[model samples]
Target: MSIKSTKIFNSKQGMLIEGNSLELLESDENLSDLKGKVNLIITSPPFPLNQKKKYGNEKGEEYKNWFTKLAPIFSELLADDGSLVIEIGNAWEPERPVQSLLHLECLLGMVKHPDANLRLIQEFICYNPSKLPSPAQWVTVNRLRTVDSYTHVWWIAKNDFPKADNSKVLRPYSKSMEQLLKRQSYNSGKRPSEHQISEGGFLKDNGGSIAHNFFEMEALDEKRDVRLPHSVLSFSNTNSNDYFLKTCREKGITPHPARMSGGLVNFFIQFLTDEGDLVLDPFSGSNTTGYCAEKLNRKWVSFEIKEDYIEQACIRFSDPILKSPLKKMKA
Candidate 1:
């Protein structure tokens, strides 16, 4: 898990530096090199749950202390207008789960800079827990119960808002359906002739338009292998790792554990950032933020402590689908 031995290696699209982000950030050479250059900060730091998870095993006071020590450096590296999006969930204890939103709020408040403004944009929920255990209290008495589901995603910004392009992320309606609807127009006063209507088309001469916002995405088709996942994501635990397995089977791509869903990342990036912006992820667990940033044509820097995870990230970054366009763009 140590990153001391890591080094930056040139790749097809960009360079992948292998080192600790904090250590690198503290170095005069590194800070001088990247100061005032980053444009966005999208990361999911470890929840201070004090659980024996794969990532690390720091518990209670130790966990909070670690986070407090790490927050300032990330704040310093962020640009004046850059956005910092941090995703954290409630730390589940067998007895009680602790919500991290207040901790996150405090973190932001403490990290606020005089020159760079900061604000909480949204406290939206990421509803991923689909399966629920029967209600514990009800089951004990009446043999019936319900389990709660959902996580929180906090969007925080510094200085100005992140640049975003709405057009690129637009969802268009089906052309055929639009045509059919247009032909059956209900405008009696301005009704056009059948031939004129046919030629003019139903909705418009151009393709049908789509609604704005992220809630319009359709559900996944298990049979057809198509999933137009919504912004408020819901995934069954059974298929949680299905996409990664499918990619591995079809294209030899190994998925990262802390990888955030592409759909989720796309929504945030589209709403909070523009193309060619620099995104920063200080506690990059599996490089999901970096992956999405690259996909959206944004430059990124990630800090990961584990060497094995970094290697995995390097492999994922080398995937043809993700790497090819970046190569083309650079070329």
Candidate 2:
């Protein structure tokens, strides 16, 4: 199906769209129109989890064909130095077994200019208990079953490396009680050195310190009373859509199911693109990417086929917490 390009929507610190991305890119528009433009493309495409839903197909052949047709345009839209991060999970069925990552690997291989197409920089695992079903064979064999813990997040870069600096987004470190006890050993008469003072001042004063990447960060900010989460997201079926609902209730707004936590999106924005760079989420779902991009001071465009999701996305973006960062950027 061909898509027609629509005018870019303009609004004050909120979600905007210009129609389906597939049709927009496939038009007679010049490729140069987007050349050296987009900084990052981060999206969690609807997993072909064989769920008999309107979003994906159950047949592997049909699934592969869909990705085959869609992957190339993404390559073309990517900036020479930009990165593409796609989150995919395994496809499972009792009767037939197939790995979705392998299909994605093959699809990516088929993109035009595989050499220039981008290297797989990293694979982030999105561990979810909800994605796993009770094991039929394992429960019978060992009286135990293991649930699937991780989904693949392929980080692809058109150039040799990502254009953004990642150290800025480093996970906070934790101080154990054992280490905390050692602080008393320091000389009481001695004043901290200038470098040590700045680095450890908060530590010296505050009773607790930041934890390492091993432990997840607090997903929500209680003081700010916002729903923004941390990079290492904790997925819960109950909390999946509750955050949006709460935010809406507080601000007199609505919710979107495809809406993801801002923490995950913020991590990608901080790690993948510099401020003011453009970010695109082709299969926008709830438009979480656009909301995150706005929060991180980046320009964003998203494409969602469903009008309901589009409206929800718009409402979510218009929330004060999401728009506050954008205002700071403009100032």
Candidate 3:
């Protein structure tokens, strides 16, 4: 199963490998230490789009079979309490505005696959308010559907209690929460649904409030203590000034066409893994997961099939915040 691949580059905290993830994960000698030790495998694999893209993807029923076969291999790389998080975009039926259930079917396939002992932990919505109206024909020309602004992020794990801490990814307290903390009082009682709220429960100010899944674009300059995060993650992928994109433009290199937002990657890496824990991204397009994991002090390994993308992704490691310089190594 040993396949020829390049180790394009490495930062002190991460390494970017160019190869087929399936073969590498199962048999790469360099990755022997990672077996059963990965804390998180966070990736946004190529979607099952109706049309093929340069990055490579399978369409329709074939995609589900392709993904299900890979689930067991992914599970084998996790520690008992390790997690797998996937961000997959929605797809539509060919030539129609109707939605496709392929994403859900793929998820179910992974979970039900005989060799994988994985379970669904939770589902989060990664909302991009600034996203342009998609499915151009249906949303714009045909005027059939509204803008599709979010992707489904599924959190699955080998164990029910995966390594996760909500406090690590908390958001800033809301205005009402700040007011409540200032007042040091509020209504607390049983509701018609019979769930009782204690006066002290809401009064105790524990930094910020728990986060929800529904997130909207908020002012980035606003600073506050971390609060609990919601299931809805709000981040836009339109930042041209990002280090990866900026460097790519300056170097006359075309960046990976599909890139995940760093904010989304940062949230899960911090929430799912601790400092020095290992994270892996089997489909590390532009190495966003590796960058986020490195910034968070976690060791990471990224697998990309394209060498050019790996080379371009190394720009992320050039930031001064990284502990060491990037090393370029031949395969």
Candidate 4:
């Protein structure tokens, strides 16, 4: 209930709170004024799995109930046109080859919650092609299944078409498309689909192409990468040489193992929120959401149960990004 105990870091643009999110939301005075004020809520909460992870996870019915309880609070925290995006990984039955339906059940439970009027806007698959094969029995030893490469990212909101701009996160034109842009003409006609394409146009360049839900990136490095239509979100599963790791090693801090993809978060931040909008991540592991949100010039608040990861996420503030188009932050 006390504001002094939970407040950790308070900068000009953001603040980090250290405590249970339920308590912080229900009682902490410092965060009290923010009820129903956040423009974007992005988090990758611990998944429900047969095996427990060091980062923490619930399984089966417990996981469903736990996640469902938070839905109403999340709805209460969003502004009228705001959006909430959660990235939840899949789970497999213990020693079984088949995947668990807990994730899907949890999603349905949240959607059906009486107090939460959230709509399932879209589902994104964060394709991590480089992830190692799991369920050693089924995926490696018996070799019955392939590597588990993608996780589900639910983009939910009160409105089906919540505040979003495709133009904000468009990808660059491919070489073939660039040549066509110069020509300034397109052959438009109706064919196999039976839908007519008006013959007069298709000449204007709408900047870059509207990005598809699928996303992929080679690694954690921030250089812009090509996006393929088939992939919603893609990035290297584990990055060893990033500055965040370097800082953690120097400080003798163990990095959070299950971190959200940097590239994935960057796209949503640009697509969903404008500069100076507020972004909140209630289950922030290593607070990657906070780091990315602040970098994009948005006001942010992050709540983490672990003090160690919260401390480490602060290091991101001082790290330099090369060739960044983001507004320069004053020293």
Candidate 5:
């Protein structure tokens, strides 16, 4: 379709469109054809920070109004079985040690809106164990509160049963489960909870174990049995020498301050959409959603208001001058 965007950078499986996401998505001149075509819309928009940063954000109730307004637009763009995944960070009250409930309010506003009429499917915690402490005065100096290190990831959809396959994101079997499978035997009896444990249920090897939504620190801890996958995704965004950062630094372009992790994008994309399905990232900060979508063979489109961020994001698709670790991007 003839999308009237400011600039377009084409990749193998997707293109980055530079423009205001809200304006571009709401455009009747072109975006009319996009309705009911997108299988997934995963994005990490600017958080409602107490004070504005270089990227952009609105505070207090104003942020709620600004954000919830996109609900109808997103609802219209998604297919009947399409899913929407959003990652929002925690916000604190201005000049106070107290936390704000703006994040939860925004989430509720989206699903409860009559025009949007969306269903809340599931919630995830994107944990960064290596994340730097935030609200420094409260956490570091005053010691009044602990460090805030997790963001909320909400998954919603137009239909209750959106397109999803948990088997696709299953984790490897635990050591105990593996040993049980090898032994091919177990006590078949009732447990204290009045639940029956059948040998047949534990015998068959389903390749891997089913993962739960509550991710624990033990998953990352070596002392414990690491489950393959969970809702509390733990990863560090402290990579200073990665290809994207290196390129940006070399070119003197400041990288998007709040770039979402590639792993977070990959998980939701693989779980929610399949190959050739269309994905959209309205915020497109550093285009992590688009980059991950392209690698997974999904058709994608990214919208960003800032041209400079888009320029830096292009480095993700292009060849790097340095021998970086991301071989898939090169491939």
Candidate 6:
């Protein structure tokens, strides 16, 4: 089980390793002291899709069993009050309008693992409005369906409540909320849905209102896409000219097509972890999680099997990009 892994890049803030995560997680000598010590584990493992990806994936029932078998190993590595956030893409049964429930079943299997004892904290939908309509036969040719434009993000932990503070991820107060705050006194009465409204507290401002679960985030440019203080995370899978992509083009290596969105990665890292908290990403394709964690001043460890992708991911942490975590976080 001891597979050779090379640390492509390292700094005071973070590090990246090139290797199969499953093999490394089970028996990596370097990670022996890290067991039960990671504060946050955020990852997007290759989905159980029918389509071919350069990183490869498993599909159908086989995918579920394979993913479930890793649950116990993940559980053993998580500290109490630590969070495991996984992003899963949906799959469809071939040549049909029916959507496969493989993602849901996978979540259930992980939660029910004998040694995991993981709890479902919340399920957030990452809406990508610009995604092209898929399954050409069912959508374009037959004209029978709308595009599946959203994916699922499962926040899991060992306990009902993990180490999280809503205040840390509060959204900006809107105009309506500002108006309410201006009018300190409110008409207390039974409103819609037969719920009674209070007077004093309703008009008070508590920094900013918490964000809802279903988040809609979009932008063409990575610099424009800022992760506001929010519990939920979303990003368009449309960043084609990022640091990793540019490096891949320069080096003649095909970039990881299924890289996790940068905005998505930043949200969970900031919300679930503190400045010095340790983060781990098992299937760290292109090491987006590692890059973002470094920006936020969180210590991170990334593992990837693809040598080319891992090599390209290191470009994000080189000289100019990561001279300092504080500089990157501000940018």
Q: List the residue pairs that clash in candidate 6.
A: none
Candidate 1: Cα lDDT at 196: 36
lDDT of 6: 0.77
Candidate 1 colliding pairs: 135-145, 135-146, 163-273, 163-274, 182-202
Candidate 6 or 3, higher TM-score? 3
lDDT of candidate 1 over 146-220, digit per residue (tens):
453444566665544545444444444555555556675633334445433343344443332432332312333
TM-score of each: 0.65, 0.69, 0.91, 0.89, 0.91, 0.88
Query: Residues 1-331, candidate 4, lDDT per residue (tens digit)?
Result: 2354444666557777777887778776767688789999999999886778887888888889999998899998999899999999888877678888888888998888999999899998776766767766788899899888778999999877789987887777777778878986677788689978775455678877888776654433456446542222333437667778888889888888788887788788889989999999998878777777766788988888887777767666557772222222222
lDDT values of the candidates? Answer: 0.53, 0.57, 0.80, 0.77, 0.80, 0.77
Q: Which segments of candidate 1 are over 4 A away from where they belong?
A: 1-5, 69-71, 92-94, 97-117, 130-148, 165-168, 171-256, 323-331
Per-residue lDDT of model 2, residues 269-295, tens digit only: 787788888888877766778877776
What does candidate 6's lDDT look like per residue over 41-105, in tens digits? 99999898887677888888889999998788888888898999999888988657888988888
Query: Which pairs in model 2 have colliding backbones?
Result: 127-149, 173-210, 173-211, 173-212, 174-210, 174-211, 174-212
**Which 10 successive residues of model 6 have the least lDDT summed?**
322-331
lDDT of candidate 5 at residue 202, scale 0 to 100: 84
Q: Name the lDDT value of residue 320 in candidate 1.
A: 65
Between candidates 2 and 4, the lDDT winner: 4
- Compared with the true structure, model 5 gives a TM-score of 0.91
Query: Could you report the Cα RMSD, in angstroms, for every candidate shown?
Result: 8.0, 8.2, 3.3, 4.8, 4.1, 4.9
Worst 10 residues of 4 by lDDT: 322-331
Encode model 3's per-residue lDDT on 75-166: one tens digit a residue. 88899999999989998898888999999999999998899999999998866667778888898999989988788889999978998888
After superposing all C-alphas onto the true structure, candidate 6 shows an RMSD in angstroms of 4.9
